[model samples]
Target: SQRVMETMAEDGTLPRNAVRIFWSSPGYSHCCFTSQNNLDPKLAAEIESAFLSVTDEDPIGKAVLEGEACRSFVPGTDIGWEMIEKAAEAEGLI
Candidate 1:
């Protein structure tokens, strides 16, 4: 992805691909994957809602959302990494 975007910038292809080849969700800027540049507004809204629902419900999804706000995606309440670590330590894994 880095190399592709770098090539895009070097070749002045970013703008063209942005509006022509790819579309991002309004809710998430870095979430840049779309089947069509001209996705229907209604469908986009539905997709966004689905994405948000997953983010809201799943523990790992919460970590993703938090990481989106911050920087790196580290384990926390979402997925209970701390609890897992404690269990592992109890079993002498750490």
Candidate 2:
């Protein structure tokens, strides 16, 4: 992990070029939220709004965002993961 790499480097424990990356995803891994099918639509919208409202500038929001490795939450879209989903289904992993 990046945190472990930084800590080891600071302590002089990590060797040069210890961490190497061959490839990285173009899109970031994201957290997704969903409600039960029977849940109220208005309540779901409120929950979504609350998540979208969190910003790094707010203390509590900052802590939550840091824990999640994200600076802030943004509105999610189905289109974002459509390709990954299709690939997973093709591999019979979905």
| Candidate maximizing TM-score | 2
What lDDT tens digits, residue by residue, belong to model 1 across residues 26-71? 4323433344558998997777666546553577877877655534
Q: lDDT by residue for model 2 over 30-54, one digit each (tens)?
A: 6777556689989878988999999
The Cα local distance difference test for each model comes to 0.56, 0.79
Query: How many angstroms is residue 82 displaced in model 1 relative to the true structure, after the best TM-score fit?
Result: 44
Cα deviation of 35 in candidate 1 (Å)?
Answer: 10
TM-score of every model versus the real structure:
0.28, 0.65
Candidate 2 segments exceeding 4 Å error:
1-13, 80-94
Clashing pairs in 1: none
| Per-residue error (Å), model 1, residue 24 | 28
